[model samples]
Target: MKISELFYSIQGEGKRAGMPSFFIRTNYCNLRCMFKSGNLCDTSYTSWHPDDDKNLGETSIESISDKYREFLCKDIVITGGEPTMYADELLLLCKKLKKVNKDSFITIETNGTFIGEFINYTDLISLSPKLKSSVPFDTPQKKMHDKSRINLKVLRKYNSLYKAGKLNIQWKFVFTSGEDIKEIKSLQSEIRFKNENVFLMPEGVSEKDLKKTRPETVKACLENNYNYTDRLHILIWGNKRGV
Candidate 1:
């Protein structure tokens, strides 16, 4: 797999938040997420500036699984710039992880733009479909990002699998403002995902900014009956890599 970094850390958001987990952060993203407030994606090194001193060029699946075994962790999170971009490699990696320890839970975080073989094996699908708030300003990637961010077909399929018990999925949105809530409502109506499976996390990488946004985010979650998740890693460790 083409990897950026692999380490052990607690899941920072979503349903599995606070769980100590092994992380496999993939390299390259199909989108460049820049919020209107000028905040870039938390892991922009894996996305917008992917090659800036962090690329761990293509490692073998065996090597990855071996590292996980060394970590002695129960949960493995395959996050990304966008994991599905390397679809076949990701599927192979997940298969190796399962083979090593079938009981170990695997979570794949994605932008919800693509579906892959890894879908069948992942225990949790952390789907963060980019909202209008994620669109970057005055950049060449803006057009591509806006055009490819939301894929209803993929979202509907995830919803179907979740309802049928074939998949465990959660819709995680980066809550920025009331506009985000409006978009989430419209999306939920279209995708018909379980309201209880929806999670709204305030969009920020720093404790101060996250603290500033939490109340409004919590308020929105309360009104919509959606679950509110905090960026536990940021709050606990500040904004830095490798936990």
Candidate 2:
């Protein structure tokens, strides 16, 4: 599969926040989220607007699994610029991981734009469906990103996976302000997400930026009974890659 950096880092967001994990960050993305904090998406190194391509390559599942095992961690994160774009490769990687370590905890960080059957092997679907705050106006990429960002039909399929104990899931939205609270409410009304599964994360790539956005995001989570997570990696390591 086409790949980016692979490293051992603490899980920084969603339900698995702050846990020891191995990350296989795939190269490339389907959407370019212009975060409300005025920062480009933090994973841009693996993106179309790539900053450093040192980690870019095509490697086998054997190599990936061996590196993940080398870390000796129970948790593994299959992340991306958009990992679902590599559905077949991801499927094979998951199969290899499961065969090697049946008790492995796996998380797939995604924009919720594309999903494939291999996801059934995941332990948590860390689905961050892009909020309107991510949308940029008057751009072709915007239209493509907007169209690909949400699908209730696809979400329902994931809900079924959750219900059948195939995996856990979280509706993790990057919260920019109170307006996003209203949008999250509207989305929940459609999907009927359990309040417990809803997570609100402050938008930013640096500690300073996260500080500025936390208050509004915190208020939204408190008032709505949703879970809140800090971006532990950003707080600890700034925006540096290969954490």
Candidate 3:
């Protein structure tokens, strides 16, 4: 499979926060998001630019397991430029990881577009759906028409996972503008899951960028009884990859 980078780090978000885990960040993303200033960017790696061919490296499942065994972590996180982009490979990889350590916990961070394919193998799933504000300003005219439709399909997949006894899934919406928050609330009404499983993550590549969205939003989530997730990797690495 095409992998961007892999390393051992604490899980910085979702239900497995602060756990010592191995992160496998795959390369390539299907979604190109527009930043607040109207710039187009890939949502794969938080720091990658849309125009840059930042394909770092690639490795097979055996190599991944070998590296993880050397690193000695009990948990593994499969993330990517949309990890679901390679569901078949990932399903096989997860099976290998499970055999390596039967008690190990496996989590997959996804953009929520391809849940149906990976549900059985995934132990924990973190679903982050792009909001309207995440649309790239310079999106090619050809791709714009399908982008909106795909986003809704992704949300429907997320709701389906929850209804299928997969409540361990966490819905994380990256909030940019206040309007993003409003949209997320509307999504909550649509999905109608328990508030505790919902999380609001500020859409930022660094701690400073995240703070620009304001701590008040976290307070707002608390006031309204939703979970707030801080991107610990961003806070510590400042948009750096392979943490």
Candidate 4:
């Protein structure tokens, strides 16, 4: 299988924040996000950019399992370039890891596009749906705004996973300039989930970008009674990957 990078790190986001964990970033993605422009996407030092050829690495399920066994961390994070882009291989890998450590917790950090195939194996699903302001509708080559963004099919799949109780799912909205927080609140209302399960993470790649979101955002979350998540990895490593 095509793997991007595998290493041990602390859980930087979501409910499992601060926990020591292992990260397995897979190669390829269903969506073509613009990373070079530094507009919407979070560019990692080790290259989390979906289309970067230099970031590509090769590994088998057995090797990955061996790495997990070596680290022996209870929490394992399977992240992307849309990790679910290769669901069959991931499922096999996760199953193998479970056999090695039955109590291991598996989390999938996804763009919420391909939940249909991976929901069963994942213990937690961090659903970070891209807001319009973050994803400009433009191709990387054209260097012009395109306005294209994540689809509703992805949203529905997340809802389905929540309803099925297959995994603990949380809605993470990445906010940037011109984003409509009220609209996101409305969407949350429509979904009918308690505010505790919804989170707002400032759209950022580095500590500087993360601090761009005013401290007041946390107050806004409290006023709205929603959860606030910080990008701990970025805070600690400043956009570095493979931590």
Top lDDT prediction, candidate number: 1
Q: What's model 2's overall lDDT? A: 0.84
Candidate RMSDs in Å, in order, are 1.0, 1.5, 2.9, 3.3
TM-score of each: 0.97, 0.94, 0.86, 0.85
Root-mean-square deviation of Cα positions for candidate 2 versus the true structure, in angstroms: 1.5
| lDDT (CA) per prediction | 0.90, 0.84, 0.73, 0.71
Please write out the lDDT profile of model 2 over residues 1-243, one tens digit for every residue.
888889998999887888899999998888877865567788877764764448758888998888877876899998888998988888889889998799998888887767797887888888888888887665668888777778778777777777777768888889887778888788778877789998899889889989988888888888999999889999999999888
| Clashes per model (N, Cα, C within 3 A) | 0, 0, 2, 6
The reply for model 1, stretches above 4 Å from the true place, is: none
- Whichever of 1 and 4 has more lDDT, that candidate is 1
Question: Which segments of candidate 2 are over 4 A away from where they belong?
Answer: none
Whichever of 1 and 2 has more lDDT, that candidate is: 1
Model 4 residue runs over 4 Å out of place are 32-40, 44-56, 137-148
Order the candidates by lDDT, highest first. 1, 2, 3, 4
Q: Give the lDDT of residue 181 in candidate 1.
A: 82
TM-score result, candidate 3: 0.86
Itemize residue pairs with steric clashes in candidate 2: none
lDDT of 4 by residue, 94-166 (tens): 7888898999999988776565555666788887765545443444623322232454666766776678775
Off by over 4 Å in 3: 37-56, 141-154
Poorest stretch of ten by lDDT in candidate 3: 42-51
Which is the winner by TM-score between candidate 1 and candidate 3? 1
